[model samples]
Target: MLRIKKLDIFVLKSFLLLFCGTFFICLFIFMMQFLWRYVDELVGKGLDMNVLAQFFFYSGLTLIPISLPLAILLAALMTFGNFGERYELLSMKAAGIPLLRIMASVVIFSIFLGGMSFFFQNVIGPKAQKQLWTLLVSMKQKSPEVDIPEGVFYSDIEGYNIYVKKKDKDTGMLKDVLIYNFSDGFENAHIVWAEEGKLELTADKQHLYLHLYNGEQFENLKSQSVISQNVPYRRETFKEKHTLIKFDSEFNMVDGSFLDRRSDIKNMREISVAIDSLIAYGDSVGRAMHAETMQLTYKPAQLSSSDSIKLQKEHITVVNVDSVYNSMTSAEKLKTVTATKNRLSSLASDWNMKSYITQNTDSDIRSHQSDWHKKITLSLACVIFFFIGAPLGAIIRKGGLGMPVVISIIIFLIYYIVDSGATRIAKSGGMNIILGTWMSTIVLAPLGAFFTYKSNKDSAVFNADMYIMFFRKLFGIRISRHMFKKEVIIHNPTYKEDWEVLEDICNSCEQYARTHRLLGLPNYIQIFTNNKHDDVIKDINQKMENTIEDLSNTKDHIILNYMNNYPFLSTTAHKSLFDNRWLNLLVGIVIPAGLLVYLHIWRYRIRLDKDLKTIIKTSRDIQEQIKNQHLY
Candidate 1:
């Protein structure tokens, strides 16, 4: 039932080589982007080789989800593009092998790759995500390497500011060093002026030892008491003195247990459990807030048992608060107003606090929900990108890194923008989380389908001629004939026969112009209701092209010149708005749309009338030259 054909193996091998190379390339690019985001944290901190290695390893693992999709896109585009470019695709199709069958192996391989991507994300990605974030947080908290500038005051240390005026790099000696020792609060800060000093880290690397030569120390004994504000100060001179500054220089790995609570660092099961718990918690909070709000509106406990029974029997009351307020004294009114204001403020504060709590809870639930869908969306991205790239590659028929690379970037960029924007909107509660997460895939699925359909049908999806014709019809763009004389004529034109075809085309154009009422306005009703190609125009254009093909080899310079004057005519551009009668009818009923279409057609109609005259004029010129016997 299972067989590995040579064609399947060949396809697999070609794609496998390309995918492997492109995967690493994409991985490196994304890793560099990730690194740049945290470059500020990594730079200046004195981290060890293995620590950096761990960072690199964890980062690469975390980036695989993003990288895999891009790699697949680029690889698929290149693989099929290369095949199409080299005419291998044509050869296969020529052999009666359908495009889908040719692509069957790569599609299956892509699905397998998608599975691998899913497994990697669901298993290894979470651990790597946690470790990488933990490392980044640790690096951000790490102290910078101690490299004091000669003229700047280095204040990176906890409490002391050390200004170095000059330093000897070779012998590790400082000429003028001023140290502001503010370790004992700034109010009681002391100053140390040293003529020359030598600084070194202790063996434990936990303290900076400063050995100074001929230095003076000034200290002010500041006091809180007013009487002691005239403080007593002391100055001492020493030939040799040593001071110890507490500075921990050793790298310490931080505790990353905090990061384990994050959504990104959790597997599918963990995320699911977390999401359920979060949703339950959010619902409980919502119910609590609802109860709190309800308490303000109804308070049954405020009534006595008998009063409650009476109120239950008759839940109706009428009060005139304005009359009561008017009957109160000014003092009583002021006291009452103050009490109500205070009560309202207290309630507002409580409500605001509760609202904040509710918002935070909802945001947390959305985060877990976002991550849950992310795993599936990212896995699906691999398959989605493959479908897009393979079909697009075949349609574009461009190989190598140049065109494929550019196209991949454009497509990937569009996907990234849409996906990121949708995710942000979803996370902010602006859209449904599932739809937002799968936004890119949904938007591109149709494109992939379209390309696949076209490639299968052997359609030129990117054919420039089709688009050119469309715009020309839309804008009434003129077409010109640029006929050049050939030096060597293999088959000279039969002037007499060419004159007959040209003369017939001229007469047909004239007859059709008169019958079609080219000088009058179009019939608006029939223009929309009836759609037909001017057969006379089609016949004339065809004959003109055929005669020109033969006449292009003419030795007569004048006849060659006359052939270039014949305008390339159109059959349907000036006809009913489109071939679809229903669309034409819809536009015709819509007065403004119909009027615009009518105006464009009228312009083309006039142009056609002039073109028909030009054809007659040019044809007559060529006929006169032929009759004169200019060539044999």
Candidate 2:
């Protein structure tokens, strides 16, 4: 028996409440997307409330599998994010509860959700899918309600186009209606003019009834069979007219037996059976094609029936194809080549046709296999996404809908694109079904593991300052130096001695610049492979620091201010590219990669060269200042 921990209950309650809210939100979003795809079918058909209700109900059910993974991701992110932001995560860790232990409840819940997703897709999804699409086709087949506008010809009605000069919305009455009837044929068309008219559906809603007051009907009296010298027409004037037109206004639900849902409407057992049948059929086709191709042999027409029959029954000496071709006359050679080309072409075409049959068979098998694997993959996606989101949330330390929403969308989109692309590739036989369907999950699982490891270890995975400092140290980047005037004179300036130290820094800078040829570009090969620290530059930097320290205590403002011009130096700017021999050798061998490193090193070399000049000039200026202050 498992004992219920308060921690587990708290975690489950927190995650589930958010999970339910997120699930509905995600489901509604997916349903809206689903509705948008068929909005054209549903709109203007004047479908009843029950039909619309059923549309959402069935569609929402079908979309549950799609929504579960994303919902789990968002919920996990938000839950852990809230804990991190509120400092609850910190307190829990401080209490010795590990991150994985804290996440244990949610992890189990996500697994359950994943299992539920599989069951829902395998069972409930198929029924909902059939009903939803069936309703969609029925809605698409339904005719739109009549809404003839003023001054416009409505051609929606079959065999007739009606233009109304004016329509009264309150009474559904039309004024100055003109109807063109092309029911019989466009050549023998009829026309009607009405001062006022009203159109209504009949009792069975299978016909349209029209009542027109003060109407005139004109129609061609001559039929297409008759060839009269003068084309004659008939005209009739009446005070009132009643006409019936064939039009169906009732909604009829259709049988969706025509729909192709062989794979989609199947459980694992049914799919396995379908897969087996398809595989067997494919094998039969392959064997038949193989037997057919094996029978094809090039036989010369010049050979007699007896010779051909004899050759077919017995083994013959191996004939040199080259020698045989060379012995043939020009005309015979042409005939032989043409016949061979024709035979090969015929074989190629037949092979292509058979190949297509087998290819399509394989594609069908892949589709079924993909569908079979999708249930398990999507279930696993829920668990994988939870791992991803929960750990990432802990890392980002952001709560509420703001950060979590953006992050969830980005991650979910990545998953969706990879999954969809891989599944398509698999279905098209570009890759194996199992690998393709599981690719996205495989891609994300390691990321979740990394995040979990980082979060559990309390690593600053997202700290910008930490990374910046690391890169700076790695590259030997120089930082800006800040120095200020001190009010208290705990130590007075040794100005004469400091001036001597400045001279020494200047001499060392000139000597190092001369030895290293700092103004010249470095060898491309030597940049990575032979990189070394400049000990002389390090010595020069120490002398400059000593001089700056002494001048910093000067009472004279000019003398003290002059020391601010001292350069903040980096010791290893010209050192090994990666601090490793193997990496340095690897980089040196790659020219394009090596070129970039060379440029970076050269830029630092130029800076060092310029720094040497500044050192000499600044040291002399400070020496002059000390001489004027006479502080020694």
Candidate 3:
């Protein structure tokens, strides 16, 4: 058992607060998206308060798996980012706490959260989905509220089309109404035209009552005679008329068990059972089909006793189809050919249908398997995203919703796109369902690990200056001089001593350049083997630093500029012409062995040559300046 320290408690408290806030925020966003997708089923149903409440409750539950991982990512990012931004992380590091140690509490908490997420997915998620969909189905089945719009045909009522030219909102009266009633049958439809009408739902909400004033009803009458060409019709004029239409506006819940058979609504055990059952069923069906096909193609003939006796007396003979066809009449040949074509066509159609059904069943099985893997993969995503987010936050050192939100959304979108694409491929049986479902995890986990490793080392992973310097070195670009504020120095009488020190430094650089043989293949081999050159460079850098400290009070800008060039000289020595044995080895092992390696080595040599020349020329110029200023 591990004991929690105060620091751990502090870190966890901050993380928990952010996690809770982000979790609810994510959940609400996901719930809104869910509502948008199913709004059609939910809207205008006049659902009861209890029904609506249950829907929202289940919807939130169902969205937990999706929202939880995103929340963890954002919260972890924000928490660590704030620490880094405020230099709290630096203080913790200075206290001898490693990044991993600082993260241990949150890592443990993330694991616990992942476990809970799994539980929710396996247990609560299915129940919520079942209930939510049950309510949705009920809502879809419930009739819409009666609000007839003017200048449009209203067909919400079954088997009837109602049109209102104008409606009075205050009086609840429809003006210039036209009703086409086809509930009895299309041939017996009744068309009613009314100057005004009032529509009301029955007390039980089972039917609609329409009372019309100054209305005319036209009904098509059915003919008793089958041969009757003209149909009889009836027209009735009424001062006021009332009619009842069958409409069930009551909310009715469907059975939740209807969706139980879906794989998404099952736990791991249930999913395994379903996968096994599906595989076994598929194999059995394939075997049965194969056996049936074999039976059809080469079925054993049943012989009677007389036929067997005849066959025993005579040898069996083979018939040649071509010779038999040649001997047949033209009409007979045509008939035989047509029969064969029709038979082949019928068999092909039957086999095609069977293949289609098999393909569809296999696709469905893959989809279910993918969903089964998704249950575990999504839970695992929480831990993976936490690792990624925490390390990334430390690297970026940005807090608040601005930068963190942008980065989190971008990463989540990438994960979603990859997961979705792989899922589609798995559903089509183009890839293994397990592999497809875990593709994003496989890709992102290594990235998280890399970020963790870098963060632990306090690497400048996101530092633009580091990458810029790298590119500059790779391209053999000249190092830029560092800028300093212009200032006047009072003392400058040590010019002769400075010249001797600069000459010594130049002699040391020239001697290293000559002794290392930096221009040839020996330089390449030296990169792989450690030599005294690195130590020599370090000594020279220390000497340069001491000399610069001695000349700190120099007033000469020329000497100051030459001193500034010391950093460039040190950099050239630090990144010697030949270094990084692994890179050399890799380049050597490639197909064109040493082609790229040779180019790089040449670039380094050229850069070193230029840096040495600049160092020598700048030292000579400083000496000339000292002599010209009569400082000796």
Candidate 4:
């Protein structure tokens, strides 16, 4: 049997779980449209198997791109969440492994997936969509659910006024129902009522049944007086109620060609771009959240009401470009030179207004492009999410399904909202193509980075401690290790001084031991410390926990170093680290990759020199760190 480390197993399992979860979720949603939109056509028109299968297959492909990013976003968050919930993230961090390293691997994997998504969107999605529409158009009838609501009266299905009451929990039996069958025999048709009936399942589960216990029948003849008859009905059960729905209930088959025409390349291109723009908008919004959070931290003071009001007023006003033509009177407009000048001025003014709008409400630009933006936006979202996810998972320092699902859902909803909003705006023709496509990514990428940063710094975003506490309460079992030193000291005070001293020593010892990859004080010494040792060690453990907390604060870097080297400062400080070239290469790669991305996005000419210099400095810093480590 092959043996694998727990970490590897966890990563693999998490990916698989996320992948499957996303796939099924997307697939289910895709399938649902058939019931809601097309089932009636198939059943009523008696469409062939090829047409029906083709409809589903192509429809599924058309949805793949839209579904890919959500799937990845959800899956990654879930995978990491599961890891975090299990405290696997904690274990890795405690071992002095950087969360960034773990994220690097996951991100690399995500990029690959992103590429796959893009391929699907470009190659498979468009053609499939055409086929799907063609198949749907060819069908003469729609599915039953399209026209029938369970427990409601409907007159749309064929020539019957049907009502469904109670239904069998498992078998889908309609307990009480009525049907007025009037196919061309409008005035003479009989009305039948049933106490119970069941919907028959075909390849497509969209059929209805009626079983009446007791009811009266009624009929009206066009040429004669109306007739009514009393009838006693029992479980004269209407079994196998297989009824096909017509697809052409609302739409004519002759007109279906126009719909198919509407799904041509031009339409698809528009749809694709719209999706892309929406995805971009989602990322941009995420980035804005990240930026706002950082700004809030850096500048915590509240804005004055006057300033807030001024900003609000500006937000509501639209750019005025029509004024350019106002200067030309009717007589002046007649001159060729004046007319040309006016046209040029108007064009320039329009451009200026667009530029102003872009700068002032960049996020809004994503909303204004067109339907084409969404497809492109959604496709690109897959890539943007990879960057956010890898770092986020690493930061959370916990690996588990539950946390990942929650976090992923939160991130996804945010992305979805912004993306959807952008799409709406685009559809309304209020923004441009580029802005709409990239807005969400631009917004959310930084947010993902900010969260990643927090996670890396050991922020409590994942709330691992809360989970531990909850688990303890749930199982009615307490782990002494989780108890704080102050609590333990208050409970057992006999050797408080010794315990406190030991705690300081242990904190230092743990830090040095981790850095040097060495054992702490000998086992014999630990054993000798005994019951008295437990109290001392417990206190020491508490102090170490405090140190861990302190490490998360950027301001506490000096304190962290001092505390870490306390007990074994002389020995651990002198230990040597491995001079691995692979590590150096990784460092080299991260600097350029991160800087290039940042620079490309912030493409202001004034900042080009400064940005380039910063990139160079970052590269140098990595080299310096590697050199310093070697010297030590």
TM-score per model over all chains: 0.91, 0.80, 0.84, 0.41
Between prediction 2 and prediction 3, the one with superior lDDT is 2
lDDT of candidate 3 vs native?
0.83
Best by lDDT: 1
**What's model 4's TM-score?**
0.41
lDDT per prediction?
A: 0.86, 0.85, 0.83, 0.54
For all the candidates, what are their Cα RMSDs to the real structure?
A: 3.7, 6.0, 4.6, 24.2
lDDT per residue for candidate 2 within 1-632, as digits (tens), equals: 76679989988999999989999999999988888988876788778999899989998888899899899999999999999999999999999999999998888888888889998989998778788878888888888888888888999889999999998999999999999999888878889999999999899989899999998999887653446667778999989999899988777889988765457777888889999999999999999877776665444346778967776788765556798799989999999899999988997998889889999899889989998998888888988898889998999999789989999999999999999999999889889899998899889989888888898898888888899999987666657655667888798877767778878888888888888866687877676776466678888888888777766776777765666776788667765677787898898889888788778778788888888898899889888877776656
- Candidate 1 residue pairs in backbone clash: none
Off by over 4 Å in 3: 224-232, 300-316, 482-493, 498-553, 557-593, 596-627
lDDT, residue 83, model 2: 94
Model 4: lowest-lDDT 10 consecutive positions: 568-577
> Once model 2 is optimally superposed onto the true structure by TM-score, how far is the C-alpha of residue 103 displaced, in angstroms?
1.6
- Runs with alpha carbons beyond 4 Å of true place in candidate 1: 222-230, 300-319, 323-334, 484-517, 529-553, 578-583, 630-632
On TM-score, who's better, 3 or 4?
3
Give the residue spans of candidate 2 off by over 4 A.
Answer: 1-3, 182-189, 220-231, 260-262, 284-360, 466-479, 484-511, 521-533, 539-564, 578-599, 613-632
Instruction: Estimate the TM-score for candidate 3.
Output: 0.84
Decide which is better by TM-score, 1 or 2.
Answer: 1
What candidate 4 gets wrong by more than 4 Å, as runs, is 1-14, 37-51, 94-96, 140-372, 390-401, 462-632
**What lDDT tens digits, residue by residue, belong to model 1 across residues 19-91?**
9999999999998998899888678778899989999999999989899889999999999999999998889
- True lDDT of residue 341, candidate 1: 100
Q: Estimate, for each residue in 1-632, the C-alpha lDDT of model 4 and write its tens digit.
A: 53555665557666866678777786677678655785545665445576556666777777777677767776666666666667777787799877766555556666776777666765676567666665665564443343346777877666677777665667655667777777657656766665555444344343333334445555554555445464333233343343443323232333334543232323445555554665676667557656855885699445589956875888945434365346767775568467678978986886576555445444433333333445555666776776566556655644555555677778788887886676556545576555655678778978877877787887766577878887854433434222122212223222233334434553444443344322232222222122121233344445544443432232322332333332211111111111354543343357665344323223322232232233234333323433454422
Superposition TM-score, candidate 1 onto the true structure: 0.91
Candidate order, lDDT descending:
1, 2, 3, 4
